[model samples]
Target: MKRSTCDICHFSIKTCVCSYVVSPKLNNKTRIIVLQHPSEVSVTKNTVRLLTLQLTSVEVYVGEKPSDFTVAQQIAKTHHCGLLYPDQNAIAVESMVSNSQTIDTLFVLDGTWKKANKIAMLNPWLNHLKKITFSALPENKYAIRKAEQSYSLSTLEACAYFLECYEKLSAEPLHHLLTGMIHEQTKFMPEDVKKRYFHEDD
Candidate 1:
């Protein structure tokens, strides 16, 4: 397999995007943690890791075993933990807080529906987390994943949207830019799936 370089920064994975991607400016002391599936680490097109790129407070960790919980556990020590999952019966993301207090540990699982389910199930600690169900009014603008709507967003997209929604700010442009990155990655997909993913709702 060949590697793709960032057109703007010209950085490769081991040295470039991973080392110097800029993070998003944040307020109110919110922290984001992306528990990426180990399989996603090598996919040059995966956008999940980009959360840490735009958000200085965000961290990314990948693995199969929950025993690799040191980093997450450390963060959970100080911040109340909330897992981002879509289940209508689940509590709203906003309700995770009380009395104007901000949550410190927010776990956003990044993967396909099947992979995410396996990861969540494999990690018992994740299941114990306070689940957050997001019902955002905004539609998902991520062109890469090409879902029916914004109702279901990728990991990075969800993080960006959550920040925008809770902070009352516009993150749409940034989300579109992330979609551009996805466009670069399309070459790696099978031709038919690539066409389907890109032209789904058009």
Candidate 2:
């Protein structure tokens, strides 16, 4: 028999994260398109799910290639595509942090660094987009999973910063939601990990 799922979060009812959802509506020119690898979708700690639950107008495409995706092709053709990848050619988003110069669409890759690299390499069309990056970002909140790099951030954190940079907006609701979610997900980790994130010394 199949278990019931939460209608909103789409999680198993037992694991429904409705309480931690930070549903804040955004009205901005930028339409965020997330290209997600299949592997990241089932991970409970993944932040893309939280982002979708919290924000509106976020288009998510699941696959490794642009042709395999439904919305990615049309999005690239119609709008100014800005990829939030930290490549050698990527421009720092801080320099373009003005509401005057707007981005029509922003594409974000959701997966490990290796998976994202593989997707971009295979999808040659992605190379044509304007690559953007952020600097001086705060440390990632995910203590449950270790990152390969010191500057690595969860998908939700990246999106939050993106909003702040492009639209002069703040994601306070998202911040609180993520804090609660991180605490709950890292319950099995050592006390130091949780303390490092939540303690006054932090």
| Residue pairs in clash, model 2 | none
TM-score of each: 0.73, 0.86
TM-score for candidate 1: 0.73
lDDT of each: 0.64, 0.78
Candidate 2, which ten residues in sequence have the lowest lDDT sum?
21-30
**How much does candidate 2 score in TM-score?**
0.86
| Candidate 2 residue-wise lDDT, 77-173, digit = tens | 8887799998888877777755555467889998988887788888888888999998668667676566778888888889888888777777776
- Kindly give the number of clashing pairs for every candidate: 6, 0
Q: Which candidate number maximizes TM-score?
A: 2
User: Candidate 2 regions off by >4 Å?
Assistant: 1-4, 187-202
Residue ranges of candidate 1 with Cα displaced over 4 Å: 1-28, 94-99, 146-151, 186-195, 200-202
Clashing pairs in 1: 22-53, 23-54, 23-55, 24-54, 24-55, 140-150
